[model samples]
Target: MSWPGGYGRRVLAEVDSTNAEAARLADTLAGPEWICALRQTAARGRRGRPWANPPGNFAATLVFRPEGDARQVALRSFVAALALYDALASLTRAEAALSLKWPNDVLLSGGKVAGILLEYPAGPGGPLAIGVGVNLIAAPGAEAVEPGAVPPVSVLAETGVRLSPEGVLDALAEAYARHEGALVTYGFGPIREAWLARAARVGEVITARTGREERRGTFETVDDDGNLVLKTAEGRVRIAAADVFF
Candidate 1:
């Protein structure tokens, strides 16, 4: 698929973080551009978590401006997760093991294989930077991740298929174009349904932790606005942001 607005593509040997560079170029660039780096010295994930930037893995960010209400832009994370799922399924032999974890994670064989992070500029109406990192050739060890974090896996380890960073980026770009189009033309209803179909653990007992407060209940369905729905003994609760665990 073609990139939105025929935006320019830039590839760098190294950078502190592609998202940082994209944020800097957002205004000057005419349209959304794809920024890819061979290595990131200070890469980060959701909530400022340090992301491993091994040379063989994929580290890329797309900088673009949203047309309408910016608050709804947060739903792009689900769109991105769907794109990543499509890209990985095209290469993996264990297709059945692939599933999308809520919020912003892609799982392979029940282990984390890829992650997405969306960042915006200082003020409103600025470009949105979508950062994606895939464990292509090497997965991080227990020591590299946070304490009690889910174990990570790489595409190579899971499917015995080796792919270059550029190769994965090509597939991702194509998949993103298709899913992004679906979000625009059909609206969030279609995207939400597609996401729920591949949901990692639906209709199961789980816990969602947001800061100090923790809520435990049966995982219901995500709402129209993308908030997670949790059915508790007391009543139904909607979580705008939280870390979920099974």
Candidate 2:
């Protein structure tokens, strides 16, 4: 498969982190570019947790100048999630086993198969980098994840479908372009509907946790501003960001 036209692709044998690489290259880029590394010596996940990127797994970052306010640019997490969902489904041919976890993780058979982390520039008015990691051939052991978090699973481990990181990137880049086009042209309405359809356990109880607090409630809808809405005993709560646990 080929990457969509006008998008740039780069494959590195190794890097400290793809997100770091994106930050370095963002200034030089006139268009969107994808950076994939075969081996990352150091990678970080949400809340600065260490991300385990095995030699054969998929670790990549997409860098582009975004439009709209902070909330709008942040909505691309959903954009990236939906793209990753379709990309994995298409490549593994196991669409039925896949579903999206809120705020940014992809699940397969109830186990985490991939994750997306978005990073904004340190300086003002700069590009955004969306880093994506997938356990293509191998997943870190359960010990690496947080307590009560979904166990990690790989595409190869679950589906017996072998794929290289670049192969996945080809499908992913194309899928992202399609979803991103919808976001840019029609607004978040279509993307929100599509994401909700693939969402996991929307009507069920779930817990959203942050460093300072935790909230448990029935998963409601994601609001127009991309906040996770939950119906709790106290009231309907909208969370802008948190680690969601089912």
Candidate 3:
């Protein structure tokens, strides 16, 4: 349960949202910090969707002052995704069962197992906060998910391996540090390659809904800038953000 050198850790009995806490602490952080909450009363996911965190599930946020523009900083989502894939592979030894969904979701046996939500920065070089939530012990009921959204699964439910929030954080923090280091040193070339290797539905037909525009296409590859590249009936499309469906 050790973080890599220089990373900070904080654990609380409860929090409204780790991302919210990170926002409050972002300005004062001297270095990267991982904050974990055993219970989140008001947790949330991307686009302000509600995130359910059961007692033993994992909910944490990593806050840091990153040196880069929004484009460069946005690449950390892929970094985090790869780190999550590695952490889960090590924890469950089910590397074959894990896959990285484009943008920010982790799929286990095709079920949504974890999610990443990066807070939109206030400016070019503003501090960044990345919120991650994993279903470790219990997943919310399938009925809780929106129509067409992937149903959730927990590590215990899927792998029969129960774990505490702290244990998951230990693995995640270390994994994140490793990928983040590569991003800082090698730029996104290596990270992109690594992420694409684990990516889901690269050659399959999928639907991407960004706002009111719904585009259907064969999933191509994530571009260097992290856009979703799709081969559509109209033509090649590069989407910066979208809700993908298969």
Model 1 over residues 1-246: C-alpha lDDT tens digits?
344446567888999999999878888998768898989999999999899979989999988886668648888999999988998888665678899887899999988999999998545677899999999889999687655456899989888899887777777888887888889888999999999999987999888888889999988999999989999998999998888776
lDDT of 3 by residue, 174-193 (tens): 99999999999999999999
lDDT for each of the candidates? Answer: 0.86, 0.93, 0.90
Over 108-203, each residue of candidate 2 has an lDDT whose tens digit, in order, gives 999999999999855545799999999999998999998999999999889999999988888999999999999999999999999999999999
Decreasing lDDT order of the candidates: 2, 3, 1
Check candidate 3 and list the clashing pairs: none
Q: Which segments of candidate 3 are over 4 A away from where they belong?
A: 120-124
Q: How many backbone collisions does model 1 have? A: 0
Worst 10 residues of 1 by lDDT: 1-10
Each model's total of backbone clashes: 0, 0, 0
How do the predictions measure up, each by TM-score? 0.95, 0.98, 0.97
Candidate 2 has a TM-score of 0.98
